[model samples]
Target: MAPKTIIQQESLLQYQCELGEGSLWDAVRQRLYFVDILGCKIFTYEPSTGKHGYQSFDRNVTALALLEDNTGLLAALQDGLAFISFDQLPFPPTNSPSTYKRLNVDITHLEGFNRFNEACVDPSGKRWIVGTMMHEQGFPGSAGGGLYSISKSGDGLTAELLLDQLTVSNGMGWTKYNKTMYFTDSLRKEIGKYDYDIDTGAVSNKVIFSNVDDEELGVPDGMCQDDQYGIWSARWGSGKVIRFTPQGEIDLIVHLPQALNVTSCIFGGPNLDELYVTSAREGTTAEQIKRHPSNGDLFVVKGLGFRGKERTRFQGSFLA
Candidate 1:
């Protein structure tokens, strides 16, 4: 096996965020879009100009995916999934939802599902999201809480049980070749891979792909895949991310400077060789908050590679 490594180049600067979690690579706009749920904000990183822009949300802005058109966004707002524009999202690039009531209809009913933890779009355009019962990695699962999905149409969304119980449903990635779907229930210390049926967006035949039993080292959180089929999982308590393959093969692990609960990672920079990471500090003590000053910050490492396509929302499969 190849040894663990870090990419050595950076084309942009690291920015501190309050609770940075989701890291979406916007291929159309050539920017890194992420959210700080506890801070209730959205951030846009423009590498070309070194400009970091932000928008504050009313509740939590959990996850974000760019529409196929490249100019809009599919936001997993605290209220629900909204065809939103942050600057002016729904339509007209000017009309915005003023109240949680007027926000995405789906969320209006499921706001209680969770603050919306992590999500990914399937090949059919359905939005698959997990409501973190615990919300935070180490916390316990909320009763009756689990996974959910919003159909491709503009109408109905459904809450289903991917698992009866879960703490943080974070790691989600399509395989390098797009044949498998890997998901992590962070507190379970288990990473699972399911047989993915792209045509129907159904997942089944799940088998454990990796298991990290050390509570002190933390369980798995968000992750990304590379062309070599490497699964780099961010360990929520260990202050490191590890690599595994689709068949449950261990590859390597890269350590971070502190255990601020690494949240998610993605390959975004030019050439898809730079790995960007998101960290969190929502539950830290005052002392911990000070010791790991980079907590809830954005970090990057050079010299890694991935072949992931920005996923598409079926409705907006308008092809950007």
Candidate 2:
């Protein structure tokens, strides 16, 4: 058996977001874009220049995907998906809710749930796979939240429901070859894999990819797949991110004692070899908060010597 490697984490940013999630790396801009779900903010950080800024919103901005042309962003807001632009990023960030134009996509049929929790792009880049969560007080997946998808066609954008029973639809990822899809339902404490169709963006044959049901490991949250087909999952309340192989074995474990409410993670940095993690201080206790003052800060894990797959941009032009 190959010796297990313990990955060490370092603090990347000190800005503690209440419920930080959705870590997306904009390769063209050499920046990382993430959201503070409860803080109702969108943040962008440039690792090389150490430049950081954020824009606040009236509703929670749970997740975001880069537009194909790089002209704007598609954000999963509390009410619905909206289009946003970063053309004004060089200036100080703003707290203007009017900055986003809501997309026509509707989820009123789901009733009661107000926001999406995580999102990912299909291999063709023409479709978006997004999952939802109940913003109000309740257990994670108890709000009847589900998985849905939206695709851009020559006519316009269309929305469709895939899975309808979920509480916290969190981390999402796909294999580099686009042959498999992995989704995380934090409340369920399991990662589900589906046989994916690249041409049609259809997913079927769902199976349990990994189960993190153990209390000591915490709940499974946001996740990203490495180049080697290893899935890296952030364990909420455990302060650790674990790598699981296709054979269902724990390949690696990266820990950040400074934060136990790790919310999400993504592979970024100039080389795409760095793993950036975002955490939360939302439900942390006073004593725990005092001990790990960096509880909600961002972290980075490096030196494992592996790169991640290139991120696919959303091909929709809704902003235009």
Return the TM-score for each candidate structure.
0.81, 0.92
How many clashes does each candidate structure show, in the order listed? 5, 1
Writing each residue's lDDT as its tens digit, candidate 2 over 242-294 gives: 88876668867887877888888889988899999999999989998987678
Can you give the lDDT of residue 100 in candidate 1?
A: 23
Give the deviation of candidate 1 from the true structure as CA RMSD.
4.6
- Write candidate 1's Cα lDDT for 94-207 as tens digits: 223333222333332222244567777765555554444443433453433366655544444455444445565677777755578888876678888888777666678888
Clashing pairs in 1: 7-302, 7-303, 84-89, 85-89, 125-314
Q: In terms of TM-score, how similar is model 2 to the real structure? A: 0.92
